[model samples]
Target: MRAIWKGAVSFGLVNVPVRLFSATENHDVQFRQVHEKDGGRIRYQRVCSIDGEEVPYSDIAKGYETSDGRMVILTDEDMKSLPSRSSKEISIEKFVPSEQIDPLLFDKSYYLEPEKSSVKPYVLLRDALEKADRMALVTVAIRTRMTLAVLRVREGVIVLQTLLWADEVRQPDFGVLDEDTHATKKELAMASSLVDSLAGDYEPDEFEDDYSEAVEALVESKIEGGEVKAPEAAPEEETEVVDLLAALQRSVDAAKAAKRGGGTKDEAEATPEKKKPAKKATKAKKKAS
Candidate 1:
């Protein structure tokens, strides 16, 4: 696998040049949206809400919506004006007991590979961490953003796992939980016995994604049985003659009228192009069933 980042792990006066690689990947099966009747792929356009005109990707800008419903659009230059960190050093802040780090705070994990010349120092750090049973708190700038992370040993490699900010984790609050509940001595004993009866050592290999496996098998069988649909050719777009802003306003009005049960069949079908996707989706559901 290609290294996603190249940097140095810095602690005190020691600096070990290393490469970062993502430690995990997903293997989930994916499906594409298509028109059920013709098997054509469903395409979505980026239409402007105010103008009802399809906007090209190049014209798009990031917008931040305020709590008061005001939008703040930021251009590429505006974003660049914001503070960013692109440092190539993973700075070790301090060493803390492994137990102090909550598993819930852990996010994406990456494997660190040392350069040939820095192998000795890398091994020293890894061995030292393993012997102390401590995790190194670190600060690293990945993708131009600074984040807190921990360096821990897994197998023979040093793994870097990013952490969520303290405020990111929400506190649990439930009215039902506020009420006092108690279990009797006999009930507690029965629960403990039940837990003991099902207790076993965890072996990840013993488990499997049964649903995903079944889906794969079903799809393979259908393919073998010649149950695939041929995709239809998409139609070319013609020049838009309607006024974009007027069309957008009309679309909004039509939607509101439909929601209020005041729309006729003709009014519902006024914009055939906009309605085609919904019509196809309904057909797809029927076909799937």
Candidate 2:
């Protein structure tokens, strides 16, 4: 795995240089938005709501909407002025019982690999944590933001799991839960017996994602049966626009050529010539002779 970040874990005077790698990934079937009729890929544009015009990326700025329907545009300089951490040190704050951390508060997880020279110190910390049955709560700066995380051992490797802030977790409030409710003894006994009968060790390998498997099978069968549509052709409007521009250009060039040659052939043929009055007198003299 590629290391996403290079940082050192600092606890007191002990600093172990390590590389951080993401420990989990998603493997779900992916899809794209497309036109159902012609299989054309769907596209979207960033449009300004007030002007109803598409906005370019360079012109975009972060805007914060106020509760009173006002917008505050923030520039890049303004964003940089905000307080953030850019340290490469994962400073250990303190160690606490691993059970104290609520599973719901956990966010992203990363695996820490020790540097070649720091292996001894890294192993010492990992072994100490395992023996104490504790997790080191630490503050790590990732992407210029500082967040709380915990360091724990998993299969002899130290894993860093980020945690959500306490305020971020919502309190569960429901009217049904507040109402007084109790299961009868007989019903409770039957439920307990049912749970006992179904209780077994959880083996992740035993579970199968039937839905994703079925989707893959369906797509493969369609391909094998030749059930597919050709990609949509380009729109004809662009070609028409190009032809119009080319015709206008040709007309301009023809006009320029005619102006340089004095006039057009049609114009010269339509012009009237000066009439000679002696033509009639010449014809009469010839007849008298």
lDDT of each: 0.92, 0.91
Best by lDDT: 1
Q: List where candidate 2 sits over 4 angstroms from the true fold.
A: 230-289
Please give, for residues 1-289, the per-residue lDDT of candidate 2 as tens digits.
Answer: 9999999999789999999999999989898888899888787878999899988666889999999989999999999999899999999999999899999999999999999999999999999999999999999999999999999999999999999999999999898998789999999999999999999999999999998999999999998999777886756444456778997886776677667778884443332342234567788899999
Residue pairs in collision within model 1: none
RMSD of each predicted structure:
16.0, 10.9
Tens digits of lDDT, candidate 1, 105-197: 999999999999999999999999999999999999999999999999999999999999999999999989888999999999999999999
The lDDT of model 1 is 0.92
